[model samples]
Target: MNTRTGKVIVNQTITADGYSAGLDQTEEHPFGDDGGDGWGSSLHSWMFDAGEENRAEVDQINAASAVIMGRNMFGPVRGEWDRQWNGWWGDNPPFHAPVFVLTNHAREPQPMEGGTTYHFVTDGIESALKQARAAAGDGDVSIHGGATTINQYLAAGLVDELRLHIVPITLGAGVRVFDGVPPRKLEQVTARAASTVLHVTYRVLA
Candidate 1:
């Protein structure tokens, strides 16, 4: 029997001003104009460029047994799934576990090269979290988001831990974290500063 309980955690990257993504998030610019050279050039440089220094954080993000993400984060395809869009991660996605995507449209489960399988949940955030938790078993269930989704979970008081990779730059207007989330007390767990990003972990106090 699986006696261990899984923690509901959120792992996201945001700008200094708390924007997870800028406006005009098209296929060409997913993260939009991030106030840098390109979309994710400066914001995500710490993950791709300074890999050695931010290895631990990278590992933590990938440690989840099940992941929950919004349809927007999954792909640019919207409204009835007109095309065959797997995800931005190509065939072998980073998460070698079940990934639950929140969407209004219904779609069949998409199995990828790795152990990953995309399960589209059209119900709601609660339903997605429930499915993710069941699939996760003893492992943690990660709410991997595009800010809007994370905000919904945060507002619902479902997140146990919040991990953020804060970049230096700021987007004047963009999709932000804690947009409609109610004020909740958080206890700092850890904080580490890398070359391009600052990693912070906080425990959502009840």
Candidate 2:
């Protein structure tokens, strides 16, 4: 029997200053500015530029059975879905599992190649989590965030494990993690250092 023993993991890549993204997010700059090059150049270089060095972390990121992300993380589209936007990833997204997107606007379930599907939840975060948990079963439900969404989960004490990929650079100001989250104790689970990023896992203590 498949046991639903998987955790609700919040996996994010943040700057040294705790910002997950920079200001003025646009279609051209999905991840916004990184102070240096542009967009995800500084914040996400660890995954792209140094993938070999962080292969284990990369694999763990995609190992989730289901994923939940905010509408902004889904795409640049805003306010009632003016146009048809699939997602940041192409036809075959990396998740390769069910993805529950938190959005105020309702949308039909978008099925993609390689077993990936996007299910928009108009209800709320808890509702989305319930659906993601059902879809995940024995696999973990990964909270793929853009800071705001992660902050909500954190504030609500819904996250089980918090996995952070800390980059060296700083964004000064932007969408940040733990912006509205209340104080909580976290037990360090594991920590690893790569060439470009440091991966740290923490158990959200109750």
Leading candidate by TM-score: 1
Give the range of the ten consecutive residues with the poorest summed lDDT in model 1: 34-43
Give stretches of model 1 more than 4 Å off: none
User: Could you tell me how far off, in angstroms, the CA of residue 101 lies in candidate 2 after the best superposition?
Assistant: 0.7
Candidate 1: give its CA RMSD in angstroms: 1.1
lDDT of 2 by residue, 1-206 (tens): 75547899999999999999898888988877767555688788899989899999999999999999999999988888778788989989998999999998988999999999999999999999999998998789999998999999999999999999999988888999999888999999999999879999999996
Which predicted model would earn the best lDDT?
Answer: 1
| Superposition error at 80 for model 2 (Å) | 2.3
Clashes of each: 0, 0
Q: Global lDDT for candidate 2?
A: 0.92
lDDT of each: 0.93, 0.92
TM-score of 1: 0.97
Candidate 1 residue lDDT tens string, 18-53: 998888888888888877654678788898899899
Q: What is the TM-score of each candidate against the true structure?
A: 0.97, 0.96
Off by over 4 Å in 2: 1-4
